[model samples]
Every structure is written in structure tokens, then in C-alpha cells.
Target: MFAGKRILLIIGGGIAAYKALDLIRRLTERGAAVTPVLTRAGAEFVTPLSVAALAGEKVFTELFDLTAEAEMGHIELSRSADLVVVAPATADLMAKMATGQADDLASTLLMATDKRVLIAPAMNVRMWQHPACRRNAATLAADGILQVGPNEGGMACGEYGPGRLAEPLEIVDAIAAALGNGPLRGRRIVVTSGPTHEPIDPVRYIANRSSGAQGAAIGAALAALGAEVIFVTGPAEVPPPAGVEVVAVDTAAEMRAAVHEALPADAAIFAAAVADWRMKTARAEKIKKTPDGLPDLALEENPDILAEVAAGPDRPGLVVGFAAETENVVENATAKRARKGCDWILANDVSPATGIMGGRDNAVTLITDEGAEAWERMGKDAVARRLAERVARALGPVGAA
Candidate 1:
């Protein structure tokens, strides 16, 4: 993978700068030719000599250097690469990118370039949590900029939370995904995950134990296989994977709308365990329990996202749904696939007896239009990979588009 691909690497100033050196080696090992660009601050953390030595080429830094510009103008260098990646993206640079401030050479090239940009953010936990950073991140995501890490853990500032750069291997994988150009290269996929909450009152709501792990894994696996994935998930236990679109939702109503908006994709996987019913009329204010018996509340049905998408004119080439049943797993799931107008359904027994619900391992039965195939219990990661491979094969291969 990534053989002969040209990658423009922008190393930002941060303690994680050394990780970029390893990232360079990983990319080159995969046969990717890398052009390392160091920011003014980036040079403070890692020297150009070391970077150039490892890259086997001159490291770019200055915008006004006479000879460097003659051979590779900032204008030319900016747009030459297939993909541009920034590891250890600091708060200042993120701000510059957000506000279109091209004052420095790195910022200038970034602004001038039309290449697809991927940034692995690294900052203090407080800075990452600031409203300003949130707004900037949202703006970048909306503009189609990709993000990887700043994963949750102990930080450099002796604090703990989400602000560490993703590991080098993960970054390399993200770069490979960008340049893969596989069969699903340009194809879009929508995946729904986790269970939704239905509010009963201001202080309480009805929910489930779903972790959203399976659906999120499916989205990542699909992205790795070369699809542009739109992952809409309810509150989940696991972090959604990097290098794909993510939409977070809390309620069944929100999940329904998101799915509709992300439709017309080449494929869809409805893995979310959306609530079947919601409070007919939830109290605006929290209802205080009284000595008197509590009032009985009416309930209403929530939209069936799977059925809606499966029946729509924008239905994908493959529409796969999940059936997390307590009993009659295959019999019921097969019926669901047909009723929902979908091509395939992955059903599993999630009864109290299965021990798979809310667990890392899963035992799924793949139900298709033709028949059902039972699979042994395995980690959700393995299941996702196998399922994604099946999707690729059924639709014909990574280069089959």
C-alpha cells in the first residue's frame, strides 16, 4: 500500500515532533516518497538536518530562500503532493488554518494548497477543551479537513484527557487510506451505531447498554478498504475511528434525521439499536416523585431508520441492517431484511444469555437474500474486518468501482 505516492508532511512544533520522524520512516518503508516541511516553530522541536537526513532530501522551511523557490516555488510546492498531513498540529497553527491567516511560510503554503489535508492534533487538555478550539475544529471538519488523534489519556502537562497525537502507525494508516484510490475510492457509505436515549423528563431518560463499538469498527474497516464513510452514532462507549466523517447524536429523532441526510450512498449499514418507542409527552420540567402514585405516560413509535433507507429511491447497491434479538435471531432477522427492503442483515442473539451484548466479542449470523451463515464468536474487530471484506467482495473488490 502507498507505493509511489507523494506525501507532503508538515511537522508542527510540539513534544510529539519526534513521532513525525518515525512517521516519515513508516511512509518511506511503504514506498511513499515524502516531502518534509518544517514550520518556524517546528524547527524548534526537531532540526532540519535530522529530518533531511532521514527523508533523503532537503527539508523545506523558509518561504524567501532564493534557490529553493526557483526550483520549487511555494506555489508549486503547496499543490504538488497527493496528500498533505500535519502531525502534532498545535493550537496556533490550527487557529491559523481556521481563520485563513497565512502570515508565515507554513501557513501560507497550507492556505495556498488545494490538496486534501489531514491533521493529528496535539495540545494541552484545557486548550483542546476551550470553546475557541471547539469552534475551530468544527469549522475544519465542515470544510472537509480530516483529523486523527489527540486521543484521551495522560498528557504532557501532567494533566489527563484527550490531547495526545495519534500513534505513528495510525497516522501512516490514515495516509495510506487517503492515497489508496481503491474500488470504493470515491464511493460514500452511511453507518448508524449505538442505542438512543428517549427522555422521560428533565432529570431522567430511558437508554440501553449498547457501546456502539461494532458500528464504529465497521465504519473504520470500510474506510480502510477505500470508502468515504459517514458514521452517525448515538452516545457510544468507544471512540469513533479516525479519518472518516462522524456525526454524534443522543436521541432516536436525531439519528433518524441524520440518516436521511446522509443517504444516497453506495452502501449503508444500520447497526444502531435505535429506541423503538419514545415518551408521548415528556415533561418540560423534572417531575418530582410524590407520595401519590406516579402518572402513567403514553408512548409513541420512533422512526425506523433501516426501513426508511432501505425503501428509499436513494437505496444503496447494498443495504445492510443489524438485528440484535433476544430470541429467534435468524428467523426474525431474515424477515426483517425482506420487510426493510435491504440486501443483507447481520443478526445476533443479544439476550441476557449470550454475554455478547455490551461485550467485546460477538457471535453473528449473516442473513442474506439467499440464505443465512452462522459465524463463531469473535472480537468485534475481527467481525468488522470479515464483514467489510464481504461487502467489498459482494460489490466486487477494492478496485472494482
Candidate 2:
């Protein structure tokens, strides 16, 4: 997809800097020439020799190099590439770019570059969530500087949250999307991600252990496939994909509403683990802990978004629903597929013992009318790419597939 493309890579300082090397190799292997610019902090993590070797070009680190500048000025260097990519975009660099801070060569190039920029952030969860960092990221997104991820998982801090950089394959896919070679190219896809939050009171809510990783990954994969993605997500721990339209929701009711509104997609994937039940009558304030006993809670069945979409008048050609099961995984998934009237069911075990739910890796069984197709344990990227291919095939060509 990247044949003969020019990719200018800006390597940032973060623990995930090592992953950027793989990114460079992948891009270069696909006939893309990479020009690497390593930040000072980035230098601490990777050697210029390694980066240059993989990129097949000299690594640039200095703001002023008379010899190099004599041939191509900084402005020319920045504009020479078809696109600019910042991998392992540390919190410092993101903040700097967000505020237009040009203290160093990396930030300076970010400020000076006219080409579309893609940043894959890698940082501690706290730093990524800090109001300051959040503000900067939001500002950058609003400006249309492309972004890929800071996925949720274990971080270098030994703490876990959403500040991890995406894997090499994911970064490559985003590059493909940016270059307009996405699998679902020119096709519209709707995806639901995360677990819906059912509020019990102003201070309390009922939710699940859904980080929204799977659904979000699917969205990114679809985007890479060249599909116009509409991501309607509930409250998830992970950051939204960069290049698509995202609609945020909370309760299952809200998710259903959003799903209905974002209809007529070429394919709709209900990957969200929407809460099946909600409080029938939630108190306006926090329920007091009484001396006698705790207040009794009432329950109500929530609206079924998957079934609704499957049965809706504007239902897409292919409707895929997730059967996240703990017991009788495949059996329940097949039943759910039949009951929901959806074209596909992706079932996974979340028995707490399986380490699947809210985890980085998944073992899923694809249930279709034909039969069930089970896969061995694999990373989420593999799952997403394989699932995306099936979607493209099922849809018949994104616009027409």
C-alpha cells in the first residue's frame, strides 16, 4: 500500500521508543522510504545507527547542521516527505506541540511542518489524563493533526491505564489510512465500543469491566481499511481513534440512541458490552447507608441495541454483534446470533479466569450461519486485522464491498 511513499518519522523519547524501530522496518519493507529525526530524549532510548540502518537514510537530530542544511533547509526537510509521523510521542512533546512550544528540534519541526502530522502518544496514564495533557491533545485533534493511539494497558510506570503507544502493525495501518489505502476505503462503517454505564445515583453508577479496547481496535482497523468510520462509544478507558468521527455515550439507552442515529453504514459491528440491566428507579442523590440495612435496588432490562439494529429498517447489509460470554461461550454465542438476528457473532470467554475481558489479548470464536471459526490466543491487532478482512469481504467492497 505504501509503495514508493516518503514517510518522515519523528522519534520521541518514551519507553516505547523501541517499538518505533519496528515501525520503521515495517514501513521501509513495504517500499516506503523513511527519514528519521530523533529527539534528544529519543536518542537516550535508541541509537542513531539503528534508526538510520532501518530507515535506510541518515538520522537527523540537530537543529542546525551546516552541511545538511546547505542542501535541504529545515523547511525543505519538513516538506520533502509526504507525511510526518511522531512515534512514542511523549507527554512532554505532546504538551509542547499542543501549546506551540518550539524549544527543541522536534517541537520546532512540528510547528514548521505543513504536511499532515500523525502522533502516537506513549506516556504514563496519569500524565495522559492530566488536565493539561488532555487539553493539549484535544487542541491538537481539533486542529486536524492526525493521531493513532495511546492504548490502555500496563505502562512503564508499573501502573495501568490508557497511555501506551499502539503496536507496530497498528501504527502502520494508521499510516495506510492516512495514505488512503484503508481496506474499507470510501465505505461507511459503524462500530459500538465499551461498556455502558448505568447510573444508580449522582455519585454512583453500575458499569462493567470493559475498557473498550476491542471495539476501539476494530474502529482503527476499519479506518486503516479506508472505511469512513463512525465510532459510537460508551465511557471507555482508551482514547478514541484519530481519523474518524466519534460520538460518546454513557448509559445503554444513550448508546442505543446513538446507534440508531448513526445508521445506514456499510457494516455495523456491535462490539460494545452494553450493560443488560439498569436501575428501574435511580435515586437523584447517593443512597444513604442506613443503620438498619442498605436500600433495596430495583432492576429493569435495558434496551437491546444489537437486536434493534438487526431489526431496524435501515439495517446495514451485515450486522455483527459480540457475545461476550463466561459460560457456554460458543453455544451461547450461536444462540445469541440466532436470537439477535445479526449476520455475525463474535464470542469470547470472560470468566475472570480467562483473563480476556478488559485484557490486551483475546481468544474469540466467530459464529456465523455456516459454523463457528475459533482462533488461538493472539494480540488484539491480529484479531482486528482478521476481523476487518471478513467485514470487507462480507460487505462486498467498502462502497460497493
Candidate 3:
């Protein structure tokens, strides 16, 4: 998809700079001509020779090169590329870009570039969440600059949070989307998948039959269509798809918090089968069989994630929820759509005989305010694609006024 595309890649200093080499390979493998720019700090992590070798392009590191400047020059070099990308965009680089500082070659190129710029921020957790960094990020967004991710995970510093750089494939997908290569290129969608486990104890939990295949498929489909997908998922049989931001959680409350954190999205699809209740107070130790009958367990309700998101002030333009019903599928789903205040509900029969609960195929009825549209049984991937197409149609053109 990136054939004949020219990407000026700026590698900033950080432990994550090593990932830039792999990123270059990923882009080049897709037929993109990558021009490597190495920052002074960036050079400390990965040698310019290695970067240039992987990119198959001359590494640009100096602002004042009499020979090179006399030829292509900084201005021409910066403006020649179709797009400018900053990978492992360290806090220093981000601050420079945000404030328009051009003391060095990397910052100069960013300042001089006329093309759209995308950044994959990488920093210490504290630095990423600092007020200054947050302000700078907002400024960059407001300036029409694009961003892929500072995905949450463990970092090299033995800390965990939202500071790790996105995976190379994820960055590639974001680059494609930024280049307007897909229909949903400019949109951001949130997807909740898997069955939330409500713990009765540390070792035992209550969950449903959801495998998370449908939600994974949906996230993959949305990303393939160029949408930025924030995948909030629980422990499930299926792993999340590539090219999406994955937020893994265990309980309903964690999932709810993750979903809210991923909000202000263009659309939200709730496919997770969250447990309705959890033990009000779980035992610190295991309950063993004794002369005394059985241990008494108190339960409390879990937050209704779909209903809350649908009725909340930060509701997305399109809200979709799933209803796994064993009887009156359409009728129950239609009522669920109304009761949950969601825009649409996909109802499916998970009866043991149907084998749809943990099976490969699904027969679903889509319930909207207009009416119910029953779809024939099909593979989960096919259903996801169809739903994604409908979503694209309903949302209209990207960035539409």
C-alpha cells in the first residue's frame, strides 16, 4: 500500500530507539522509500551505520554539511518527502516540536517540513504524564500534527504505564492511515472485547463463554479500513489483532475504566460479555469444606459499561452493544437497545445446540431504532467486515462537516 511513498523518518534518543531499526524494515518491506534522520541522542542508542544500512539511505545527522547542503540542502530534503515521521519521539524532541525549537538538524527538519508529520512518543512514564508533556501533546494535536501511540506497558526503566512506543506494525498501520490509504483513515473507534472475569477469590473467578473472536475480528476490520482502534479487552481465548492499541484488563471495573480512558472516540462497540456481579467481599483465604454446610458469599453488581457509556456525557457518535440471548433474540435485543440507550445492538443466540457461544460461525440480528435486520450465519470475520462497512456508511465521510 505504501509503494512509491517517501517517508522521512526521524529517530529520536531513547531506549526504544532500537525499535526504529525494525520499523524501518517493516516500512521498506512494504515498498516505502525511507530516509533516515538520526538525532545526537539517537546516535547513542543505535549507530547511524546500522540505521542507514536498514533504511538503505544516507543517514542525515548534521545541520551544516557544506557538500550535502550545497546539493539537496536541508530545505529541499525536508520538503521532498511525502510524509515526516518521528519514531521513539523522545520527550525532548516532542517539546522541541511543540515549541518550534530548531537548534539542531532533527528539529530543523521538523520545523522545515511542509508535509504532515506523525509522531510515536516514547518516554519515561512520569515524563509522559507530566503536565508539560501533556500540554505539549495537546499543542501538537491542535497544530494538525498526527500521533500514533505511547501505548501503555512495562518500560526499560522497570516501570509500567503509557510511555512505551507502539509496535512496528502498529506504527506502519498508523502511517498508512495518516497517508489517507483507507476509508476510516481519520476516525478513532473504541472496541471492548472478551468476557470479564469477576473474582470470587484470587484463584477462582466467574466468566461467560465469550471467546473474544468477534471483538478481535471487529478491531482488525476497523484498523484495515484505516480507523484508529483502541481495543479494551479482558482475558480471552483469542489474542488482540495487530495495529490496534490494546488495553488488557481482568475485571469489569478495570474494563470500565479502560473504556472511559479510551473515550471521546468517533464510535464505540461493546462486544464483551461482562459478569453482572462480583463477590462483595472476597475471602482472603480459600474456603474449605467443613462440618459447617457451605460458605456464605455476598455479591454486588458490576458497573454496566455499555449503559454508562451510552448515557454518559462523553458518549461517542455511534454506540454499538452486543446481546447474547438464548431466546427471543430479536425481541430481547431490540429491548436491550432501547434500555441501554445504545444506537445499535447485535443479538445472537448462544444456545448450547447452536454452538455460537464459542463457535466459529454466528447468526445475528442487528437491532436499530429503524427495526431488526437478521443476518445469516457466517464466520466471525465476515460479520465484522459487514459491521465495519455499515459503520463507515453510517458515519458518512471522514472529517465531514
User: In order, what lDDT does every prediction score?
Assistant: 0.83, 0.86, 0.88
TM-score, candidate number 2: 0.84
Per-residue error for 343 in candidate 3, Å, reads: 0.2
Candidate 2 wrong stretches, greater than 4 Å: 14-19, 67-72, 123-135, 151-165, 199-209, 278-300, 378-382, 399-401
CA-RMSD of model 1: 5.7
Deviation in Å, model 2, residue 131 alpha carbon: 5.7
Best by TM-score: 2
- Could you tell me the TM-score of candidate 3? 0.59
> Which of candidates 1 and 2 is the stronger one according to TM-score?
2
Task: Return the top candidate by lDDT.
Answer: 3
How close is every model to the real structure, measured as TM-score?
A: 0.69, 0.84, 0.59
Tens digits of per-residue lDDT for model 3, 1-401: 79999999999999999999999999999999999999999999999999999999999999998898887578887999999999989999999999999998899999999999989899999998898998888788778777766665678999976688877876786688778886688789999999999878767788887899889878877876688899999998875765678899999999999999998999999999899889998777777779989778888999999999999999999999999999988888888899999999999999899999977788998988889999998777668878988998888777688
Error of 1 at 304 (Å): 5.7
How much lDDT does candidate 1 score? 0.83
Candidate 2 global CA lDDT score: 0.86
Per-residue lDDT of 179-267 in model 1, one digit per residue for the tens?
67544566788999888989999878878779888887788777766788999999888667655788999999999889889887888
